[model samples]
Target: MTTTTISEVKSINTPSVIQINADIPLDQALEELIRNSKEISITRGKRKGKFETGADKEGLELLPESSKERLQADGIDIQAGYPEAPPREDIPIYLDQAFEIRNYDVPFVDRGKNADPEKKSLFGAATEIINLTKNVGTEIVGLQLEDLTDQQKDELALLIAERVVVFFRDQKLSPSAQHKLGDYYGNVEVHAQVAHVPGLPGTTVIWNDYQVKKGMNLNFATSNLSNWDSTKYLNVGNQGWHTDLVHERQPAGYTHLHLDAIPDVGGDTIWSSGYGAYDKLSDEFKKFLDGKEAVYVSAHQYLDREDPFGGPKRIERVHPLVRTHPATGWKFLYVNRGMTKRIVGLSPVESDLVLNYLFDVYEKNADIQVRFKWTNSKQGYGTSAIWDNRISQHRNVWDHEGDQPRHGTRVTSLAEKPYFDPESKSQREALGKYLHQWD
Candidate 1:
């Protein structure tokens, strides 16, 4: 047992001594001194009971040994705390390198300007006369599928690669003919879970009248209503902004809708370019959004809320805030009202603010949108439209109310999953592929 007194405790960048009253074992006395001390110094005394000087510190001694090792680890410089010295001034973020804001304004031009003249002409008269909007989309006319030759097919494929969506008017092709035409583009797959015309396996019918009647149990008197219930009814089924059938592990790629029967009034479809929506966002918003993900679940729209028919009915999937079209290599706004739920990295308030702002942007940009109004003309009867699901959104307007029933068949194409690419930006070639010259 030994007795010691702290005498005059000094900090001196080292452990200070504390005095003990009684003669005691070194360990016990040290523990009692530590317990009684007003504050404990960060540095502990050396085994020999002497405070460690800067020259004898273990950390200082190990620095040379660490430097002598051939393999050097890369990370924060722990020895220096910060590299070289602490930042003198708050580091300035280089906007160009730290963030990139893409231009969404797509230019309209002759898609064949870069191709050989002979090869360009090979798409037939339609390809020759039709021009594409230089901007993010295109509207095509003149070349009917019935008259499309092999050269035209090739040209159309090229156009599709450039423009994300293509619209044709006065098609005059039957469901079988339309399916045949779609076959040239890709493998046409039937929508696994939608109303289809009996016996017509390839076609999915967008039936407002039929759906309404069915809802009312086929009783006409009970189903008649003066006003339209946009939410409750299927005036335009799948009206929300969404890529088609993204709920499935595998989603449909190409969507073709032919206006077989047009009402005398109302019943038009509107499309918005996802690429344009992405391009219009502010740099601050884009940076905050970059690398963040969101949940997309189909069951939210398809499943019953009160008593979910298929178990709890949740089909959540994570998708990036911005995604690049795999085929076109263009960035697009990846979220949709129909499927997107909460953003992955954001708090509830933050997610709502950002998503609502994006939704407003998509709604306000008229230049990046196209509205297809269906007329009862013979040419309108033949109108068939095909668009890329990965980068486009479509909505059908249900304003027609008459005894005359309207119906059409849709053929969907199977496509690969959506992904994002940070390197490539939206280009004219990509825009030209879908928006034909004839807008």
Candidate 2:
């Protein structure tokens, strides 16, 4: 029993039978921990005097209010979820560390493409979230959107924030439920700049279903010649990476997207960890970036046509390049390829040089990202990936043809405006203790 963060020492969805997913073999799990130990470690006092500005500090000294909320949130005991496990056991792990996989008999289902759990899977992503990637994602086994409970909603949000992003496979989540899920976090944020669902209010319909005209003759010769892929700095109509609605004065906290209609292989989406990106910066660069401001403009495809009723004339706001998470108190990079135009104080040249460099830092690193393939499951099946818009960036790859449907409803929830706190820790440090290897 070494010094551990509260999160590590406390119950992870206690009494819920939390087992390491069965699909993850022992060696693979250990390797993941080893990776966590190396790439994600942010131990206190590790960077003393490394930068001229000072050194990195570790916060999250206190467990959040959600920790208390977690206890009352559900009645699930640790044994219920995973009823099948081997007897209590332990083995000496890497060096001074040892991890024990106690195979206690519990209800742990590693549901993939065809998941039909008698009770849990049919419920929703909240009931059966399985860790899908090493660093960033968790897949909810077989949860139905309509079956989610109030406690599950709260638990799901907390868990998504934990994993950065969580996925639900074959979800039949209705637009109303999607909207309701958004409401669980905060008010349904209506987009001031992008197109919203015509009658449903607060929903955005982003798809490429309309057929191009078959009879092309007049402008077809030159029109078809202009390749969309060749266009630079063009907003390819939301295909590139972006945080949703960053142009708002107070950016949306959570964005939930359900891909009900996706092409078989071409419409996969990927998300990168802002917290990981922040952690990877050199101390000097980190010092230079922290507390710096960036300006994001909601122009291009985001121009607000709904400004007829005295809406915001322009969508623009200045936010810290690195911001602290309100709940976990972790610092995450806030700039994105889509909305962030320039670093506020720097000159145009300096901003472009530095921004391009930082963008490369994120774009080049695959370790901090998770790419997902959608099944576009039928009426009772599909996946809705929900994430903390504040601490992550995502983009959809448009590999499909124009006629293939990739339809989904999105709901954004409003939260506090962006602000950076010096005392914040990175997500690695915040959850490091829970990472068995680090603790």
TM-score (C-alpha) between model 2 and the true structure: 0.62
lDDT of 1 by residue, 45-118 (tens): 11001121111223223322222121122121234211011121211111121112111222222222244334
Model 2 C-alpha lDDT per residue in residues 51-130, reported as the tens digit of each score: 11111121011212221122123331222211111111121223112111111222221111122212242244444546
Residue 48 shift from truth in candidate 2, angstroms:
49
lDDT of 1: 0.51
Q: Would you list the C-alpha lDDT of every candidate in the order shown?
A: 0.51, 0.56
Instruction: Give candidate 1 misplaced runs (Cα > 4 Å).
Output: 1-123, 127-139, 216-236, 299-312, 376-381, 427-439
Worst 10 residues of 2 by lDDT: 47-56
What C-alpha root-mean-square deviation, in Å, does candidate 1 show against the real structure? 26.9
For residue 197, model 2's alpha carbon misses the true position, in angstroms, by 3.7
Our tally of clashes for model 2 stands at: 28
